[model samples]
Target: MLNIGVIGAGRMGLNHSRNLRQLDTIKLAGVYDILPEKATAYANEFGAKIYQSPEELINAKDIGLIIITSPTYCHIEALRIALDAHKPIFCEKPLCRTQEELDELIPLITNYDNFFALGFVRRYSPNFAKMKEVVDSGELGKLLCGEIRCLHGRYVRMHGDWFADYDKCGGVMLDMLAHHVDLQNHLIGEAESIYAQSFMLNQNEDELPFDYVSATARFKNGFISNIQCSWLRNAPSDTEMTICGDKASITFSDSKGLLLTKGGKTEKIPVDEAALNIHKIQGGMYAEEMAYIVDAVINGKKPLAGAKEAIDAMTFCFGMMTSAETGELVKF
Candidate 1:
């Protein structure tokens, strides 16, 4: 069994631990967090060792792999520590929140000796996979412009949480839209330029923090995408994406499976949700993702989403933020 240590005992950390346990070849070696008290539940539930610090957990002899699920701001330091130890890593998305972190991280990630995977879990989702298959099959002919819509309710985890802080979370664009941005890059093509606008991450005293952003991207492969994401009050959480081509168009949703359209006729493509997500847990994509990373560690193979994709996705999303801030289009 491959022993995995985790940093950050927050929701994502615990979520990954639970899913890692579902795989027989994986062991929950240990976990660490700045707040030791927050990690007791993880230690007790998984019988994982409670580590004193991130340095300790990552450097443990028993840990063959490290998974960083820490908050966005905290990711860079832990990532560096893991790299120094030469351990294979599986870090959750939005690899780093700012330009400085990216500058320092890019060189290390590219030169790391061991496999490094980023958690763009949506890549492993069934509906999105089916969408890619149809798009690549050429039944859609020449791919054209597309649109991605990601909407969410206001930030509910408010009680002075880091997520409410724009500096820490990078708002909805960096935190939530990274997933769809990666999908757009993976399914569509490389983005050549982007123009975007947003609320600039403003919040009133004692009010829940919220943000909304819309970005238009022109791809190098001669296609365009309108990407929108939001965290607003009284809004129902939903995600939808559609890509149109000369022959047909395909649309997919987190809750609605997939659809194919041609000549004014639409067809629903069947997806095996239960079979695809056997664990049937929340963020079910993480289950397959955890297992895949373990295999990559064992075989010395690259993950479907690795350092290159992580950096590329972050570049595209961050460019959108820069455009929103400067009121200008960002070109790659």
Candidate 2:
């Protein structure tokens, strides 16, 4: 078994632990969190040991891989430890909070060929994978332009909540929109230029903060995408992406299966709804993502969303944030 050590016993860490149990080849070896109760609870429930610190987990002889599901602020330190130990890593994304961290991180990992995967869960979702396959297979013909819309209900949190802090979570752009940004880059190409704007909609003393942003990006492959995302106080959560090509168009949603429009007709492309629903309820795309990483490490195959891809996706996101603040188009 490929024993995996997890840092952070929060929701994401819990999800990863559960999914790791479901895999026959992977074992949840140990867990660590700043909150002793949290780590103890997860270890007890999952039948794993509780580590005294992240250093212990990373250095554990049984752990062949380390999953960093810790908070954003702690990701860098955990990753540093894992890299230094030469352990394979699976880190939840927006890999690091700022470009300076990225600068320090990129050089550190470039010379090492250890297995490192980031959590861009959408890449593992079957529906989005199908969409990517169609777009890349040329079945949709030459890519023209695309649009992505992501929305979430304002989860109420206090001022001290890390999610509400722009510096910690990087607001919706880094926290939420990073998914679509990665998807956009995955489907089209690297962003060559970007223009973006945002409105900090609701800021109340009693309730959590919220933001809405819209960005336009031109890819080096000559495709353009208009992306919008929001953290709202009174709205249903939904996400949609439509990629238009010269011959046809492909659109998908979390609730709806893929839809292909061609020759004046549209049809739903079939997907395994029952299996997808089970994965969603269990760990959603995260479960699938973990499985893929496990398989990669076992078989010596490279992961699709490695450190470079993670950096590229975050680079695009930071560019958008810079554009939003400066009110100028930022270049990749």
Candidate 3:
């Protein structure tokens, strides 16, 4: 069995533990968090051990894989510790707060023959994957444009002060929209140029961070795309994407499943029963991603989403943040 150690017993971390418990091929060896109670809670519930420190978890002889769901700031050091041990790592997205950190860590990763996968769960969504296949197969007939709209109630402010801080979370663009940026790259291509606008509606003037953002970009493949993200909405949470092509259009909504429009006719694409089962939980993608990493480590295969793809997506996100601030098109 693949022994997995999870660092951070917070919401995402605990979810990982639960999923790992359900996978027969994997074992939840241990977990660690700065908060003793948090770690203890997960360990007791999952029947795994709790370590006093991240170092202990990393140095554990039985832990072949380390899943880092710690805060964004801790990602660099946490990943470094795992890399030094030559342990395979599956890190959460927005890898770090700055490009310089990624610059320093990229070399360390290149030096070791280790498996690394970033958590871009949307890529694992079967509906999105099938949409990509359709677009790539010429079935969609040369993608013309796409738009992704994601809106969630402003529960983030309730989490903590750090979440509302732009420097920490990189605002709505980096923290939330980064997923769509990665998805866009996965489906369309690298963005050539981007323009963005952002605001802080219903927030105090002293907030010093944006709560909503909308960006438009031109892709290298000659496709134009628009992305809208907001944490200020008071309505039911909704996320939807529409991709238009020469021959057809594909639409996906988090609430509704998938739909296809072609030749003046619209039809619902029947949801895959297996994929639906996988999408039932937040941990589904996490488990599948870890499984992919395990395969790569054991079989000498490449990860579904490698570091290069992650870096490209982050670059696009950072560029959008810059564009929003400068009111000008930023080119990659």
Candidate 4:
């Protein structure tokens, strides 16, 4: 069994723990969180040991894999520890809060030979994977412009939660939209330029750092892409994206399988959920991503998403943030 240690016991961390527990080839060996009670809670529920610090957990002899699901700012430290120990790692998305930090860490990461994967779960979703295959097969003809939209109800952060702070989470741009940004980069190409703007809708005493962002990017492949994300006080939660090519267009979501529009007709491409077997796990996308990294670690297989893509996505996200902050287009 591939023994794994987890850093952080929050929502995403707990979700990872539950998914790790479901995998037969992986064992939840230990967990550490800044809060002692949180670590204790996770350890008791998952039947793993509780370590006093991240240093101790990553250094544990039994932990062959380290899963870092801590806050965005905390990822660098945990990653450094895991890299130093030469342990394979799976870290949550938006690798870090800033471009400078990510750039500094990239060289250090290049020195390690161990496996490193990022949690861009959409790549693991069956519907999206099929869409990628169809797009890459030239079935859609030459790809053109695309649109990605994600919206969620008011994200009122806890009193001291870093997620509510722009310095820590980079707001919706990093915490939420980074997933689609990564997907766009994967499906389209590297972003060449970006223009964006944001709004802080919550004007109350308990204000959020950043709320809504609308941006457009031009890809190196000569395709234009638009993205809009929001965390309004009262709004519906939805995520959907569409890509249009010369001959056809593809669209996908959790609710909608995959749709292709071609020759003046729309068709739904059937996705074999049973064959994917991701439905067998109760933890949803988190479970699928966790299982993917576990398989990669044990079998010496390359993961669908890893550190390079994660860094690229973060680079795009930070560019968008810079554009919004300066009210000007950012060029790469």
Candidate 5:
């Protein structure tokens, strides 16, 4: 069995651990976390060892696979260890928390010789794939503009946790909006410039950071997208993206729906119908993403998305944050 060691025992790490445990071909070999108690709990529950450090986990002779599910800020160091270890590895998104970290990571990732994948699970959604197909096929004409809305239902839920700290999680921008930002950069085009505003950066010492952000981006291919994301105090969850072209437009949402409108008509494609049945064929996008990484690791194939794509997304995201900071258009 492929022995996999995971670094992190937080929310996302635990989520991935559950999924990893569900995979029959892999063994959940060990876990490492700064918090020994959390790591111990995971080790005890999952029948894995508590690796004292990332180096210990990565250096394990029997553990051939590494999965880095640590927080955004914690990713860089752990990833550097795994990348240099020459083991097939998977890392969760946003790449890193800051430009300094990005600068440190880029060369290593580019020069790395082994399998390296970044988790951008939205790519696995059939709706996303179909939308990409339609846009690439020119069925929507030349991609022109778009909007991405991600309302996270409510904001009061994570009051006293690490996620509430903007310095730690980057509020909603790095924590949540990165997914849609990557999607737009993927389906729309490479980001050329961005202007963004956020309530996150300015905070009193005693309070949590704000939970809203809006960013407008112009792509190299002349595609423009306005992205608004918020964790409203009390609102229903909603996330949708609409890309428009000269001839038509396409819209997709994970739980909402997939739609296409052209010449005053709208309907779901057969892919959407197939998407309705994806749960029967495989697990949801998360599981499918994990399975894809596992397959790539075992078979020596590249995942649907990898390091370069992640870096592109992270670069664009940083530009947005820069724009937010300066209150001016950031040219990339």
Candidate 6:
């Protein structure tokens, strides 16, 4: 069994821990968070030990993999500890707020002979994976254009002081757009230029300006894509994408599930057999992602979403933020 150590007990960290618990091929060796109670709670629930410090978890000989779900600011240091300990790592999105941080981690990444997978869970979702298959099989014909819209309500209770700070979370664009951009890059390829518009609609003394963000991207492959994300929408969390092609069109929705409308007819694609399992026990995308990471490590194969893919997505997001600030299109 692959010995795993989790380094946070926040929402994302808790989700990953639950998924890891379901897998028989892996064991949750320990968990560490700045809050001792949080770490201890997760450890006891999972029947795993709780380490007093991150360094202790990283240095443990039994931990074959380190999962970093800590706050965005602490990611670099957590990753550094894991690298120094010569352990494989699986990190959450927005690797770092700045390029320099990523650059510094590159040498360590190259030197460590272990697996590293970034969390871009959309790539592992069955609906999106099928869309990719259709595109690759030439069933979609020439990919002329694509559109992605991701909207969700911000958990007011969940947005604590640290997450509310723009400097730490990099605002809504970095924290949320990274997922859509990663999915776009995964399905439609790299973008050549980006034109974006963003704003802070709802603000209070207790919260930061991370309520809404939007961007339109022009891909190098002559396809155009748009993405919208929000933390203030009252709608029931809509996430849908449509890829328009010469022959047909493909679309899917997280709210209504997979959909295909083409040839003057619309049909709901049958949900994958794995979907029930994914939704029931594993909590949808998170479970799929955990399985993908385990397979990547054991098979010595690259994951559907990796560091380079994440970087491409983040580069576009950074450019979008720049565009929003300067009122100009940014070219990659």
Return the TM-score for each candidate structure: 0.94, 0.92, 0.89, 0.94, 0.93, 0.88
The most accurate candidate by TM-score is 1
Model 1: per-residue Cα lDDT over 15-112, one tens digit each: 88877787777899898988878788888888899899889889999999899999999999999899999998999988998978888888999888
After superposing candidate 3, which stretches have Cα over 4 Å from the reference? 110-112, 154-156, 200-210, 276-287, 294-299
Model 5 lDDT-worst window of ten: 274-283
What lDDT score goes with residue 239 in model 6? 77
If candidate 4 were superposed on the true structure by all CA atoms, what would the RMSD be? 2.0
Candidate 4 lDDT over residue span 84-189, tens digit each: 8888988888788788888887886656598988888888777888888898999889999999989887566653567766778888888889898988888888
Write down the lDDT of every candidate, Cα atoms only: 0.85, 0.84, 0.78, 0.84, 0.81, 0.78
Whole-model lDDT for model 6 versus the true structure? Answer: 0.78
Model 1 regions more than 4 Å off: 272-283
78: Cα error in model 4, Å: 0.9
Worst-scoring 10-residue span by lDDT in model 2: 273-282
lDDT of 5: 0.81
The list of candidate 5 runs beyond 4 A from truth reads 157-160, 205-209, 272-283
Cα RMSD of all models vs. native, in order, equals 1.9, 2.5, 2.9, 2.0, 2.1, 2.8
Residue 324 Cα positional deviation in candidate 6, in Å, after optimal superposition: 2.3
| lDDT per residue as tens, model 3, 219-321 | 9889999888888635557898888999999888788778899989989887664763442333555666555566676677877776877788888888888
Task: Give the TM-score comparing model 5 with the true structure, all chains together.
Answer: 0.93
Model 4 error, position 76 (Å): 1.1
- lDDT tens digits, residues 1-332, model 6? 88888998888888888887788789888899999888878878887789988999999988888899998888998988887777778999888776577678766765557787788888777787787787788877899987877787754523456776656776677887788778778778878998877763333665443467778889899998877777663454777888888888788787776666679887787757575355345566788788778767877888777667767777877788778768899999
lDDT of 5 by residue, 1-332 (tens): 88989898887778777766777878988899899998998988899988888999999999988988887788888887888888888888878888888888888888789988888888888888888888889898888899999987666645556677677777777778878888887777678899999987335656544478898889898888889888766667789999998899999976657889888998866575555334343447787778767777888898877878888888888888778878999999
TM-score-based ranking: 1, 4, 5, 2, 3, 6
